[model samples]
Target: MPNEIPSRQELIDRAAELVPLLQKNALWGEENRRLHEENLDALTESGLLNLRVPTRYGGYESDMRTVVDVIAELGRGDGSTAWVMSVFAISTWMAGLFPDEVQDEIFAKPGVRVSGILSPTATAVPAEGGVLLNGKWSFNSGVLHSSWNTNAAVLLTPEGPQPVMVAIPVADLEIVDDWHTAGLRASGSVTTVARDLFVPEARVLPMGPVLQGQHRSQANADSPVFRAPFMATACATISAPAVGLARAAKESFFERLPGRKITYTTYENQAEAPVTHLQVAEAVTRIDEAEFHARRAAGLVDANAAAGKPWTLEERARVRLDLGSVCRRAKEAVDILNDASGGSSVFTTVPIQRIERDVQTLNLHAILHPNTNFELYGRVACGLEPNTLYV
Candidate 1:
């Protein structure tokens, strides 16, 4: 049977329906420093894991907007779960950029999960049939639950050090259970070590071409879902989780607002205070702005993909700006709400504290850092070239 591409709303609804289950298992994931099996099962069963898989492989091949919406919905449930899902979505889309044979091998299994990291931390040396991969990649989200990992490595070439993306089976690499973190603990983003691992030439892709939308996959050459520049799509997809985190903060705050009182104050109802009103209004506005940036970024990717348009430097920078803006605004919103929740919100049972930490972690990411993105966009706007190629 052919895979039916669901409407955007249908996919979002599916994600929305899984919130309770995700919430139910959030604590378990946090406590264990990994996602619960129940959460993974729910995501796989919901078809959310297949959002970015190739259509020929029974996956949805959803556009950026649909991808963002679904991820945001998941974020509304659990930050770590949503963070891992976003990584899977990006990695699966990257898998589509590989040769058709590789895609067949990867997507052949049901509910395929691919985790990835963008930094070229590993080195690849030429060997008989392929290259010998060696080095360690940290912050490999979803690696513990993934079948494959799409990692970046520097390949020695006559021209110079050429960066390439390599797809390796998780079993082939050594996993380090050192994922202790203050935020997104459940994501289980442990470090993976590749000790002289052999990578076939077929599974290796040059990063330069892939970044510019010039990929080796003839099979997916005309696929609209794979049309946009890699960074643009990634920035757009990653930004959605921040919006989700902000929304989750909002939900957590309002859920506890009605009966709550201003501790050490005469106000019987915290919601009745003018300061509370201001905080709510400010947080809600920031959340709205974060969503606006997220949707705009997704819209840019989707529209460009559909039209097959060339990306201007400013436009590329704008995607990064959107990512930074979403992270900044979302974190701000979460902080506001978390602060308003008072001392009681610090309890393990409260979701706002976790959401706050998750948003802060997001803001600290090198690529997603608000100030870095803002500077990049400003540089481009001022007629200067972008400092990095990842834009």
Candidate 2:
């Protein structure tokens, strides 16, 4: 339970009660390829909607592991719900690192949800008191239910070019509605367009020093809350959903095993076969192993943050390693389960196919891109500069 560790367990307990409903509701998400309003309400009532909100704003301010467990539970039933909640809710915390003005503007109201697209696809021109921003953000997850959106933008001045993430109110922009994808379709990861929107000085935070451990939030000044880098924690949130989906696949396979027969074999019940035992064991093992790795990484993160020490590059890179490995393990577990599930595993009635498709789509995310993170960790281990700032 979430409360058993760094977060309150009551929240997760409440969330668990909704699992069957969410499992039933998952199809609506897959059927329409978009998160339905009912799914939104279910999550909101489950306390997941506010899991990442700062305690100062009537939220749990939960630890990463608690968040992980909660998400894993949701993901076990529906990867789409889990993935959307992971990205959207974690970004809610990311919004807290901004200046108080921006933070107040975004979270001051009730029922407000924030969505972010970090791709640097915009240009900001300096104005008297603020910057004039114009750009389009791709993969704006949770845009449909969000009241605010943050986008990464580049600042071009006569002096030079610099990068900054600008938090923009969704009211200031237009939705492009282009979120066609194979997996995580319910994310509603549409594109947002902003043209010549004049942003106030208080609304924008400079990029460089803040990421290197400097922050502007008065509440964050001495608090380690803002000190934790998003990159290191980001994957833990993303990968938990994968672990949950794999768990779902395993359960679905077992549930259908007794009713189905092996195509080429004389087995009437797959569960009674020795090979079924072997494959099921392998899948369950892989899923458990992934959870262990994720827990290790998440524990280190909370420990260091609680102690007020900024995680060193070594530690951060290690977290990246843990993240990539967990994703691979989760996928492996699902593949094993699907294989054991036989040809019928892909039927529209079988949840294995959905879990399989979900894992495949989730694996390709830029944040979880296996080869890239692995190489970054390798270079770091051998004493090389990080391949990118994300590490």
Candidate 3:
């Protein structure tokens, strides 16, 4: 049977429905240290994996708002699932940045899934009709199920080592199971190693031009989603998941309030306590703030893309600032919820504890780190160019 492509709302609703199932399998995924097969099956069946594929290839060709909404919904279920989906969707969107021939072959695969890391951690030495890739890349989310992987490497050229983006089949690389971490453990973000592997020249996309809004694909030039500033949209995509995770934490904290008693206190119901009231108000407000910043960032990026405008320095800096704020505020909200949930919340069996850890991990990410982005934004606000290559 052919897969039915869903409307954006339908896909978002489907993701919401999967929350309970994802919660049920969350422990299994954590224990196994990879995305649960059941969760992956459900995601694939729902057509969520095709959210960013071109419409001509039976995909939804979803926009940034839909991407944020769907991933955020999934984050409420399992952070790992949501994280993997965010990476997959972003990488799939990048396929449209490649030349028509590359996009044609990549999207041709049935139920195509792509995963990637944009950091140029590998080296590509020039070779006949291609380049020889020899290095390793880490934090490759969703590597386990990907059909193709987009990697960034410094190309050995006469001028200098020009960093470029290349898409290669998963069958051509080696997967190293080194993703053991404190949070987002189920994401299976293992390392990929390629030694002396030949990647065809046609598969490479120049990173410099793409970052500057110069694209090689005439086929997708008219697509708003394809024309957006790459790094800004990418950061926004990952930032949305943290908002959903924080919301889950808030909901879990409140749901247990009705029957709970203040520990070693005279209060019979925690819900009636003034402290509980204040904590709930504070956490909920923080979550709202986080969601506001995330949505704002997504809106700005999408609007620019729709208008076919290049991002000014301030616009790019603000997106990073907004993303960092989202992660910071989300983590802070989860922390408050954790404290409010009492001692039991720290147990391994408790979902809130896991959510807390995942949000902390999310904040620790270099891309989402509050301090780093703040500094970068500060630099740009001071009328200086930010040193980061991503913008």
lDDT of 2 by residue, 271-366 (tens): 788988888888889988889878887787678778877778888888888878778888999888888877766676778888888888877878
* Candidate 2 residue runs with Cα over 4 Å from true position: 1-7
Model 3 spans > 4 angstroms off: 1-6
- For residue 69, give model 2's deviation from the true position in Å: 1.5
Among the numbered candidates, top TM-score falls to: 1
The residue-by-residue lDDT of candidate 1 on 148-228, one tens digit each, is 999999999778899899999999999999999999999999999999999999999999988888788888999888888
Candidate with more favorable, higher lDDT: 1 or 2? 1
TM-score per candidate, chains pooled: 0.99, 0.94, 0.97
Q: Residue 262 CA error for candidate 3 (Å)?
A: 1.8
Predicted structure 3, TM vs. truth: 0.97
Best by lDDT: 1
Comparing candidate 2 with candidate 3, which one achieves the higher TM-score? 3
**Candidates sorted by lDDT, best first:** 1, 3, 2
Residue-level lDDT tens digits of model 3 in 24-117: 9988888888988889889888888888998778887788888998999999999999999999998999888999999999998757889998
lDDT of each: 0.93, 0.78, 0.89
